[model samples]
Target: MRRPYFDLIATGAKTIEVRVGYAKICKVAVGDSLRFTSSDGSLFTRITAVKEYKSFDEMLDAEDNTGIGEAGMTRDQLLAACRDIYPPEKEALGVFALHLAPLPE
Candidate 1:
């Protein structure tokens, strides 16, 4: 199974700042770097800065394997991909549909 992870939208996002709990992940830190290609096919780097921490927000394991690395799958790309995969059904419950449905809502 693909590891479940969060994709911070690059749209209107000045910089890809991943909050690993309270501490923000940075590129220069001694951390693991992950390469990602946006939906526009732009090459970008993602770094997992914080390794160990205790916080209220769910923490992502640096070693946890997860990614949908299709070319041109930037934040927007992923959203589109997901929408295509799980399109809205005609007779779906409005409430449940809202929750299970993909982003871009």
Candidate 2:
């Protein structure tokens, strides 16, 4: 999660947690529960759905800015930011989109 996106997740404005790393993608499954902490506070979330993509660009195309909007960023900025974090080679490795919902406290 990124700054405002982290905030969005905390506030329930964002409900998807996107990951391009194998470590996270491999471990998570639908019905899984996760806890996260950020400057806003702590959050508990449940995985409701999981989607896999062959590439980040493909994922972006399918998503059509839904996640970016939740992050309060334009498509270009989000893409650029992702590129900065994940180079082209890594992006091509693929991504996982996890649909989330707040879990009961």
Candidate 3:
């Protein structure tokens, strides 16, 4: 994860982790736990839900931008950022919205 996104997730401001639907990621179940690591540290979160969409635009329409981006980021910026990370080839596979919640301390 990028530092900004990771920080947002760490602070409980971001709750949705977006990724391209790779085969391995598709295998992750709702109850699975994920560990996100940054230079600073690592945080644990549980997958609350898994949603699939044809494109990032479609996923953005259904998911909250606030949960996927930094404070005050516009939907267009969020969409562009997602696209920048995952190219057309990857997006063609699918988009995955992994709803996340922090594990207990």
Candidate 4:
């Protein structure tokens, strides 16, 4: 996650962790506990839900911009950002919508 997105998650403003890397994230299942670290700090989160998509665009449509909006990004910005990280060819590999919540402190 980027700093802004990480901050959003830390502040509970964002709930879904979107990943463009399908292979690694696909192995993560619901109920899995994951740790995230950022400049803000580290926190433990439990995966509440996991949805797979055929492409980032598909995931974006399914998410309805809620996650991207939370990160202060518009749909086009989000798409361009994702493309910057992972090329459009890789986008077809799919995406993971990992719904997350903070674990008990």
State each model's C-alpha RMSD to the native.
15.3, 2.3, 1.0, 2.0
How does residue 92 of candidate 2 score in lDDT?
68
Model 3 segments more than 4 A misplaced = none
Looking at model 1, the pairs that clash are 38-72, 38-73, 38-74, 39-72, 39-73, 39-74
Model 3 Cα lDDT, one tens digit per residue, 71-95 = 8999999999998899999999899
Task: Report backbone clashes per prediction.
Answer: 6, 0, 0, 0
Error of 3 at 56 (Å): 0.1
Off by over 4 Å in 4: 69-72
Off by over 4 Å in 2: 69-72
Q: What global local distance difference test value does model 4 have?
A: 0.79
Q: Candidate 4: give the clashing pairs.
A: none
Tell me the TM-score of model 2: 0.79
Per-model CA lDDT versus the true structure:
0.29, 0.74, 0.92, 0.79
Candidate 2 deviation (Cα RMSD): 2.3
* 37-92 per-residue lDDT for model 4 (tens digits): 88657888999999888887888888857655365688888777777778877776
Question: What TM-score does candidate 3 get on C-alpha atoms?
Answer: 0.95
lDDT, model 2, position 17:
70
Candidate 2: residue 34 lDDT (0-100): 85
